[model samples]
Target: MSSFQNDTAHFAGLTEKQTATARLLAEGFTAKEIAARLTISESAATKRIEALRQKFGGITKNELARLAREEFSGSPSSHTVKVFEKNRDFSRAPDGEKLTWKNFDLPNTDGFRNSMPRNRPETELNFSDGFTLDATPPWRARREERLVPEVLDGEHAAPARWAYVVGAAIGMAILLLVLLAVADALGNLA
Candidate 1:
């Protein structure tokens, strides 16, 4: 048998929807795009793709697309196959002339090779004597290095403590309202 017939025969067991999903996948359509094309939910499209994967003996999506492409290439379909032109000129001009360093318009390379002989101005700083200071600042000092006064250690509360309480109260109120609304809805259903 021909390769096209052999490839198509492999997917003969797939349902119409499964075949369509595979064809869309081979055409580079995402699950969301496939869902839109087939008028199905995105999750449904994903499930169909997963089913195709399982049906093909746990092959990857790319492999499935390859198989689908081989299967559909012989069949006449409305989906247009896109052809991309490759860039074959490896840094050469269109007329086949090789590019030179002068094409970049770079600076002179004469003195740049031996930069060790270049002289630079020295940097200096002057500080007065007896400028001793602690290595760690007071704020960042370790707890053992710093001692807190008894008056300052009385009580410490979080800044947003009231916000949490208010949020809880509002959430409870909303929950109670939803419960009441649901109860009323259920009562009217009788």
Candidate 2:
């Protein structure tokens, strides 16, 4: 058999579609390319790749491809190849033998009919415990609670205050120099 067919022979447990997906993946096809080539949706192709990952003991795509090539190339002592061969015999149990919820009681349909109040009279509205019917707005009620007030007031203000001080000092220095120059000119005029 050709190498591709021989490589795929190790994945006998997979469905035909899954087998095709594994082959395409081993051939270095992207999920989008696999989808287009197999006439399946991209999501379906992605799911097939994910299933292949799981079936091969959660190895990556590159590792899976390498394992496939090694197996096909007749490397008989590969542990991963043995795992693939062992997974083939794991047939699912019959439906009747499987655990299901058939014996559980069906839920009561009428139990939720009046669970919530519907159109109660406004006069009958009383606040429950831990609840308030008061008309006070949230912002007014919690006006004392400031978010990050320390960071806003202390940390941010320090740099701004230093900048203002430096700017004021520079302004004063420039004003003093201008005054000195004007006094020197007035003395020269005299």
Candidate 3:
């Protein structure tokens, strides 16, 4: 809202190339050299410098140089410090991490047992051939086991039920004979 807010806010709106030019200009680079360093046309670089001057209220080259070191020149708030702080941390990581592969973690195969590319001194891998199998078997099994007993299926349950009833009858007859013998001995003693 105020006329003299921080200028770094506008710097945020500038393209990456503009930011690079500001940085180079601050570092004592000429327009031509800045263009060569960035692989851009000199005129384009010059235009960017002119644009930088306009953004800082028509500042001359010296004033532009001054503004390059300034924290905020374009709008109000200075974000350059924050941006550089972030970039300083980001550059230490691998390029794959900085780019589209930020989620990729470096491989740490410390506990992996089945690591590939086995380095055998004698055997070599055949590319076209399939992988080699590494299985072994004993000559014969030591223990002998009989087949499982045949289960009485639903249809055969009727015949099995009669056998169970016969077994129950035999058990009851033996029990009754014992009880009768005990009663006869008691009767004789009376």
Candidate 4:
């Protein structure tokens, strides 16, 4: 037996990231593929593997992989392929048949689309320009309402106007301060 066969002490010092890298390596993944799976750069993945190598008594990567496989050999790996029956098509539903429009006996309303009523006869408000402003499905109309800004035209308008003016003044002041700071930095650099 190899010295690593009975050794679980080597895994005790590993960080969670290193453990995950080791698990992937054990499942026959290349460092590049491990990087993609871990959402890290290839160099980062290689560094992690190298770190693992150092921790495992300066062993080669292949030996590290073998150790990893043994370490995780008892647990189920997702990459392990299960045997399927030779007569079965696993991708397709066993009882399902191919469906087309003819299966439902649907009418072929090809070019007669314009002849169909755009809005239901019972609908209270339907704009000719294709806006359904009524409340059957309230969310759609509410979405359209949110897209348009309200025009202020009453006692509240003066306060709103003043608020806009104040906001503009503050924005311009901030912009002027930034430009002055940049100019000062540029002058100092020269």
Name the best candidate (by lDDT). 4
Number of the candidate with higher TM-score, 3 or 4: 4
Clashing pairs in 2: none
lDDT per residue for candidate 4 within 1-190, as digits (tens), equals: 1233333667666889999999999888999999999999999999999999877666667657766776677544323322223243334633222111122456778766868677677667656755666456744444344432343455587787778789999999999999999999999998
- What do the candidate models score in CA lDDT, each in turn? 0.67, 0.65, 0.65, 0.69
Judge candidate 2 at residue 129 and give its lDDT. Answer: 82
52-159 in candidate 2: lDDT tens per residue? 777666755665665555543555533322323322222364542222223366779698685776768889988678865767776664656665446436767787
Off by over 4 Å in 4: 1-6, 75-190
Tell me the tens digit of each residue's lDDT in model 3 across 40-84.
Answer: 999999999999877766645654565565543442223322211
- Point out where model 2 deviates above 4 Å: 1-10, 71-190
Which candidate model has the greater TM-score, 1 or 2?
A: 1
Clash pairs, candidate 4, are none
What are the per-model numbers of colliding residue pairs?
0, 0, 9, 0
**TM-score quality measure for candidate 3:** 0.35
**Candidate 3 residue 11 C-alpha distance from true site, Å:** 1.8
Task: For candidate 1, write residues 84-116 as lDDT tens digits.
Answer: 123334365443122222325578998698686
